[model samples]
Target: PTPAAPHREQAAWWAVVGWLGLLLQVLLRVIRGAPSSLAKLLRSLGLRHPLLSAAPAVAFVQLPSKAPADDLPPLSPPPGRLTVVLDLDETLVCAYESSSLPATVRTQAVEAGLHCFDMEGISSDKDAKGRQRVNHVTVFERPGLHEFLQKTSEFADLILFTAGLEGLSCRTFILLSIKSPVSN
Candidate 1:
């Protein structure tokens, strides 16, 4: 390599860092409702230091100025309504593979009058013969789950968030009598 290779690489790195710092500063200004000029922004962020003074400009994109709220239409839902986001596993209910769940625990949950249901889900793993397996899951509702849903749905829109399979999540919400506007 040439003697100046390291210096060139270092300068390039600083240029990238400067660009990222400038973008972050702009975003922070927008969030804080502050206005700034490009030169003033760079000076304020210390990007004009001797080490970065010779670095080439990274980007020249122009950011749009913030518009007045009065000039825009209302984007939120009606005042009385709100969004209620709930997670599926461990938040609203607990689920386990029927094969792995102990019989005693199942019996105790049933005896305790905790609402429970069974659903079949596809396994992400291959079976012994290298074929996809169907997993039977037993889901138990957390205490006061029903009442919480009833009260929350009264004045808010409910959204279910889960990393589980789409079909499995939809089926669970269906069984719970709640709408599932689920996304991955």
Candidate 2:
């Protein structure tokens, strides 16, 4: 097994036939809709200039523009100012992790008057003497959440959003005091 193992197995079988001939020339230039040009597909796979001087001699295609929605530009919404976006966890409230909450579901949601609270955040993790942990949550509202944000802020412009963890929805909207003007 020497003689440089048959020239290192014929240079790893021509480096797997030069990466399967550069992935069959990029799958036949993406099934022939062509016009790619990574330096003309590495100079049609003979690949030179040290791999065509690091590619990019035009290959940014875009395409979509049959133009004709009356030359597009009229997605409306601003002749009366209405915004309303809302959705902070389960739509308008329902947190939990106050150390795995459950003191009889926080005393039956505070004797069923609901509208709970207890947010507090700050913890992208870092303790063991680096400080920055304090997490606790709780939240709860969502029974006509403050009369649907005071009747959608007297006609839209509410926002609030959260795909989860914007520091626990900005500490559940500053512990649900919400006088608005939150920002980021």
Candidate 3:
């Protein structure tokens, strides 16, 4: 049996109302994307959005509003070679942080025949420490680190700086397969 015409009209009106509600939601999203809109909403709640506060300070990136340079000088060569410096501990080795040793480095060195060595003490072997000594040593490098070091060095100069023992740096780099750095 065909539905009554009045019922059909009522169903169409409900569908139209739902569509209007969806369009209104899209409009709300667009309006909310504006920083000012967010700021106003935040203010209404007795708060200031921190990002909005600092944005104006950096917003206008046009030429300096103040006086132009009084005189321009010819550019001079940079003082030294373009050197990239990297830290050995966190930057090169993966350490446990709170534990005595960064797990990965310690394990790698041991497997490579480093015996009676403690990660806390910067030692290549038991005899090197002379006795029970404790110092956090970055013994190995991060994974996939050799390829990165090689590729980077082949292009630009790289420097690996470490506060570890004088000789430790060499062994550490070797263990990590890091090539001789452009500069130490």
In terms of lDDT, the best-performing candidate is 1
lDDT of 2 by residue, 106-135 (tens): 898878888787878777888999998878
Model 3 TM-score is: 0.34
lDDT of 1 by residue, 93-117 (tens): 8999899999999999999988888
TM-score of each: 0.52, 0.28, 0.34
Cα lDDT for residue 161, candidate 1: 86
The weakest ten consecutive residues by lDDT in model 1 span 48-57
What TM-score quantifies how close candidate 1 is to the native fold? 0.52
Considering only N, C-alpha and C atoms within 3 Å, which residue pairs clash in candidate 1?
Answer: none
Per-residue C-alpha lDDT of model 3 across residues 36-121, encoded as one tens digit per residue:
66557766888764533434455565886666566557679867545678787667665442355556756767687543222443
In candidate 3, which residue ranges exceed 4 Å CA deviation?
Answer: 1-81, 95-140, 174-182
RMSD, model 3, all Cα superposed? 17.1
- Report, for every candidate in turn, its global Cα lDDT versus the true structure: 0.77, 0.73, 0.60
